[model samples]
Target: MDFAGTDAAEKATYSTLTALMYRACEPIDDDTSVLARVVGCSVRTFKKSLEQLIRKKLILQLENGNLWSVQIEEELKNCNENLNRLSERAIKAANTKRNKQKDNSSREHDEVMTTSSRGHDNIMMSSSRQHINNNIYNKKLKLSF
Candidate 1:
């Protein structure tokens, strides 16, 4: 998969999703040091990035805990599934386009070969006619002799 092909929204969503999962492994309370740590995010920039994930609903707080449950993992999985499908489609489209271009190139090559063969045939025919004409002239000269 080409990284360049990934859209900004998708990339953002992927990272946010990962943050939710990482934080999920920790405790879920606001007072928990894990919250501060996750919120602090030295791990994959989740420090400040955690708040961003919460705001996006990609991460959620369990009603009253200091531990996060990775509330958005399933959703992120679905999104990732969709993204995978899209990537597959784009790759298939590119392959089809390449195949079509190859077919067109081969067709053009065949036409060129046919055209060259016809030109060679014409040259041969013209030379044959000139040879016949010379022969006729020679016969006339001999008869006159």
Candidate 2:
């Protein structure tokens, strides 16, 4: 529905092709020459327009020169499907990245906590050893006296 990326020429060609396609689909004969006359464009320009439409995948050119609009529907469907697939993939990738970051942060926190506890244990051991040495020195002084 949104032709944001398409150019003016392409839009014109598409509009013309839609008209041609509608006429082609009718029960009457699908005459390109008459269609060209009705569109007020030279037959050569009409052929170019048809080629442009086909190149853009907005129309389908049959072997018998009867154009069809089948590709228009198919292309839109394909675009929507591809967009959905890409969107899902992007979401999955973001989630994976987020989870990895959370895990890394958790591991970092755990390592910091372990290091902090180890430091506290070392301080406690040092203070206890100093207390025991002082007690032994005091006992020796009493014995010598």
Winner by lDDT? 2
Q: Note the residue pairs that clash in candidate 2.
A: none
Q: Candidate 2 — what's its lDDT?
A: 0.71
| TM-scores of all candidate predictions against the true structure | 0.48, 0.44
Question: What is candidate 1's lDDT per residue for 1-145, written digit by digit as tens?
Answer: 1335444443454454456555564543454344345344344444345455455554565666432435455566777799999999999999999999999999999999999999999999999999999998888434553
Candidate 1 Cα outliers beyond 4 Å, as residue runs:
1-68, 138-145
What lDDT tens digits, residue by residue, belong to model 2 across residues 90-122?
999999999999999999999999999999999
Q: How high is the CA lDDT of each candidate model?
A: 0.60, 0.71
